[model samples]
Target: MSYDPSGNAFDFHGSSYVALTPNLRKLGGEVEWDNATKSATVTLNGKTATVRMAEESVTVDGVQQPLSGPSLVKDDVLYVPASFFRDVFGQSI
Candidate 1:
């Protein structure tokens, strides 16, 4: 993960975590952030995943799914679970 002065990137429970923007891009997804709602819209492969900070619920392709972990925000950067790509995008890590 790239360094962020804001301290939003780190490792937890043996999983590496980074800010949402980079994670989205790494997954080949386009992201639109909504600061007001503290949510992110990620689009890839004709699917949309809407995730809200501090929420365990994610909407993928207009269907709601329970997340293994909540989406978190620290220092204004959104942090998603490391398994997000595998869980939400159907990709192996």
Candidate 2:
């Protein structure tokens, strides 16, 4: 799923998924954002994963997880794969 700056949604990655709104909580188990570090933390099943905004990839328990699609940062907001939520948050779409 891909959402442009204009809020237009598309399945550019062929996942056929689209988020109606940017609801971090609904997409994951627990979501935390650190404004100072510009990073987001997602905890699932007692496992915590941290994603740095400026970084090209994210780390799960210190192991790098390659992203399948391009991450879009627009207006200071980062849009990543909803699968990331499922992987780290143990939630299903």
Give me the candidate number with maximum TM-score. 1
Q: Could you tally the backbone clashes for each prediction?
A: 0, 0
Residues 15-80 of candidate 1 have per-residue lDDT tens digits of 556577776777687999888987899987778999998898899988999876777777778887
lDDT of each: 0.77, 0.59
Report the error of model 1 at residue 38, Å.
1.4
Question: What value does the lDDT take at residue 60 in candidate 2?
Answer: 80
Q: Which regions in candidate 2 have their CA more than 4 angstroms from the true location?
A: 1-24
TM-score of 2: 0.59
lDDT of 2 at 51: 72
User: Which lDDT value does model 2 have at 5?
Assistant: 50
Please write out the lDDT profile of model 2 over residues 35-63, one tens digit for every residue: 89877776666777777764546778778
Clashing pairs in 1: none
The best candidate by lDDT is 1
